[model samples]
Target: MKSRKFYISVFILFLSVFSVFGQTRKQLEEQRKKLNYEIKQVNSLLFKEKKKVNNALEDLNDLNRKISIRAKLIATINSEARILSKEIRVNETELKELRKKLADLKEDYADMIFKSYKSKSQQSRMMFLLSSQNFHQAYKRLEYMKQYTDFRKKQGEEIVHHSNEVQAVNDSLLVQKALKDKLIVSEKDQKKEIEVDKKHQEKLLATIKKKESSYKRELQSKVKAEKRVTAQIDRKIREEIERANRIAREKLKNAPTKPKSVKKNEFILSPEAKALATKFELNKGKLPWPVSEGIVVRKFGKQPHPSFPGITVNGTGLHIVTKQGQDAQAIFNGSVLNVLVSADGRKNVLIQHGNYISSYNNLEKTYVKKGDTVVTGQKIGQIFTDKVSKKTKLIFVLFKNTTRLNPSSWILRR
Candidate 1:
């Protein structure tokens, strides 16, 4: 009986440990799968475009971090699974021993009940009393009777206790079975995740192979063309600023008494332009795309040479590639400041909004003339598609006063 009680206590402790480990394994598996899914999503975003290649690198770094976390989680789960397996074995062994003990307890209880029935008659009680010769012997016999009854009660209690223990062992077995099922499912999911990770790695490799050569040459050519266009636009913007300053100076000189508050060096913005810039800034995220449904091919800033060693490309704004025959639209309501016709016969449109200006280059035909008031989303010109590549690209730029600013910063992050 003492050994049985000890085994029961140990079995309960083992069950408690098993339950905790199973729950931990389940939680860890869920976290691992979630991390794997996030990695897959980031990988997809990385290969969508050339301009976002750097973003992809950041995503890759993020994936690596997640993978590291997953590895730790997997190790933890494995350890828990091993612990559960061992505990399950222990439970099975304890259950077999408990069953054997319960059977022996049941036999002992049945024998006590059978013997009590056999000795229940009045004749048997008289014989038992007569067997005592003296009064002290009779008293001792009465005490012995009470002890026998108590022994029978104790045997019954032991049988009940053993029955309860058997039920507990059965419950533990059920729980262990459930834990085993969960572990199997988790292992299957882990294998699937590993397969997905391998596929993503292959995809990344393929992307590099397909893009490395042509992407390099294309990036170089685009960089050179962008630099030339930026220089031209900068020169034109400087010229416009000088012309405006000259006009302002003349107007100041002609005026009898200029306001004391207005400085000669300061270039005051027209009310209309100020209002337009304010409106544009107010609709930051809601700004219209320069060309509808186009993908940004070139981004703002200096980029490494794609093909040549130690070569680099610089961009002042963004270049969008769109379908053929797409019209470049005004992102905001503004007046056309200049219609540029480059020496190479390319057309560009410059729109002014207060002290800010936006330029759309690589256009084939202009729909809005210089000084024309264009509303937001209004078509300004049709974009010129490169015949060789069959790609319609528009060079879009923004400037504050005469200083160039990154268009990407002004546009929505998405």
Candidate 2:
């Protein structure tokens, strides 16, 4: 009867541990699989294109990204192994304790049966009860027999319950061992991948060192192109702000009902524009990507260049690089302001979002024209691809009135 309580406690403990440890490891394994798939994509799409162009710097960057992801996958595998080890140890202990308890319960049940068999005759039971000095004592004796019978039945049930528990724990232990073995194999594979990437990075560095001057010149040209586009974006935003303010001032002067003053760097906004601005602000950090599939090669703000010790790249927006022929989409609903072209003939489409503006540039061809309204994910243009470098990159910018904002902060991270 006492062993029954112990069996219930063991089952409850198993459930609690399974809920925490088992579920967490399961989620980790799923995440590891997704990371592996992304790494595979990098290998096929990014690294496999080096034969067509001599982009040693870009190649190194891709290799570094894969190495980082491999390290994270290995770390997750190690965590799963540790969690499985803990669960296995607890299960083994529980199994051993249940076996001992089952044996003790069976022994007590057999002894009770042996004694009861000797008093099985009705005459013996009657005499035993009659030997009590009073009616109350006789009633107490009958109650004792009933209690003993209930204890025997409970002992038999506890033995069966604990036997099943022991078997279940043994089975679970086998599963834990299998999972550990699989993780061990995965960890070893990732380690080999990291070693391979390190060799590739070293080779790319040597290649870069051989053509240092030419590489620096190429970097300078790229930086100049980006600066040119950013200047155009800022100029366009300021012009639009001035134009809207001028219109608002004219309306206020001619209204005759109520003349009002207009503020600098402010645009005349309609009720619909005001509502859109509020909704856009509320959706910050949750906005969809401009490109369906792309990776950010250059982030916003000034950061030190990877090759040059003191050289820094001043960035005004996110530079998303994708495969050739990929289309650039609008991140939010807006009307196109202008589709400006650079001196080199690359096109950029500017879209107005209420009092804000977003620019998608470095496009070879644009689909949307001036004064056309566009919704989220609408195709704005096809991104430009450099024939020499075989790179398709886009420069995206945002402006509130005349002040520039980081486009990366408003969009989803991945």
Candidate models: Cα lDDT each: 0.68, 0.78
TM-score of 2: 0.81
Residue 14 of model 2, lDDT score: 39
Q: In model 2, which runs have C-alpha deviations exceeding 4 angstroms?
A: 1-31, 48-51, 110-142, 251-263
Residue 130's lDDT within candidate 1 is 88
Model 2, span 1-414: residue lDDT tens? 122332354345434434323448778778778778778766655655545656876666666667666766777777778888988899889888988988888888888888788677545777889899999999999999889879888888998998888889889989889988988998898889778776776677778778878888888888887677677767777787787667766766766565334466766776688888888888899889888887777788999775654567987888887778999999899899788888889998988888778889899999989989999999999999887667788888777767778988899876
The alpha-carbon deviation from the true structure for residue 30 of candidate 2, after best TM-score superposition, in angstroms, is 5.5
Model 1 Cα lDDT, one tens digit per residue, 220-252: 676687678778888887777667667755766
Question: What TM-score does candidate 1 reach?
Answer: 0.48
Against the true structure, what is every candidate's RMSD? 17.3, 11.2
lDDT accuracy of residue 187 in candidate 1: 64
